[model samples]
Target: MTIRYPNGQKFTPVPLRDKREQPRDHVTFSNRGMTLEEDINATNAYYLNCGMAVIHKKPVPVQIVRVDYPARSAAVIKEAYFRQASTTDYNGVYKGKYIDFEAKETKIASSFPLKNFHDHQINHMKQVESHGGIAFVIIRFSQTDELYFLPFQALYTFWCRMMNGGRKSITKDELTACSIFLPLGLSPRIPYLDAVESMYF
Candidate 1:
């Protein structure tokens, strides 16, 4: 299958690794090689099951262009294009407050590159905040196995600095100073709501 962006750029999906290739450790609370999105999905599921919150990943809008009838009962989509660029990863309501956030992970140890974010995403977050909603970003430093919940205001500050021809990245120390550190857990995986409660509530 071939999927293209709204700008006609080919979209290459990341290949999933086999679980058998990963080393099994005794520490269950650790991330255990799960991607940030996977961990968040698991945490959202837990929240939903426990009647804590209502959140879900936003689906990308795609327009199917070509399909092949491989068999009488099977139809294979061959080509598709995104209908539009997505704003953020997830959004919903929590504790009667609107929640919107994007999740990103990097393998860098010293800093997280600002190039990972897009202008539209930042603008969307700003709009969300302007309307009295909570907007934030969840960043994962894969090399250090660290996670941080950075509010949109903090992110906007760094983004504005970059736009003004300053540094092109956010240092780990800067994130530590301005963002809330999220500890890994077993049931929720990434315990971000705890940080949200501490910072916002």
Candidate 2:
């Protein structure tokens, strides 16, 4: 099966290693082998299972253009196009507060590049905040296995700084000082709501 974007760009699955066959010890950290999207999706599943939250990844809608019938019972998609997504990555309700955020990971040890974000995402977050919703970012340093909860206000400030000739990214030192660290756990993996409690409550 093949998928493509609305603009005719081929869609590639987010790179993910086969967890069943891979050695668990291959990476030092619990999240070492997992991509940011995978971890967040898994964590959201955990949350849902535990009745902690109802967050979920928004499906990337696609427009199918071609299909082939290899067998009577099997229909394979040969070509497709992805449609534009209108919302952030994950969202749901937690204790009456609407939670919405995007998760990103970087290999850089010192700084997280602002280029990691897109204008549409920033606008989405701003909209979330404007409506009195909980808007934030969960960024992980994959090389260090450190995750931090960066509030939208701080993120917006950083964005402004970058636009005004400041550094194009946020340094680890800055994150350590300004963001709340999310301790890794075996179940939910990213305990970001803990950071939310500390900052908001």
In order, the Cα lDDT scores of the candidates are: 0.85, 0.81
Please write out the lDDT profile of model 2 over residues 28-119, one tens digit for every residue: 22234457778788888888899988888887678989999887678999999977556677899877888999777776688888876778
Model 2 pairs whose backbones collide: 4-80, 4-81, 4-82, 5-81, 5-82, 6-82
- Residue 90 local lDDT, model 1: 87
What are the RMSD figures for all models against the true structure? 11.7, 11.3
* Per-candidate clash tally: 0, 6
What RMSD value applies to candidate 2? Answer: 11.3
Q: What does the lDDT come to for candidate 2?
A: 0.81
Output the worst ten-in-a-row residue range by lDDT, candidate 2: 24-33
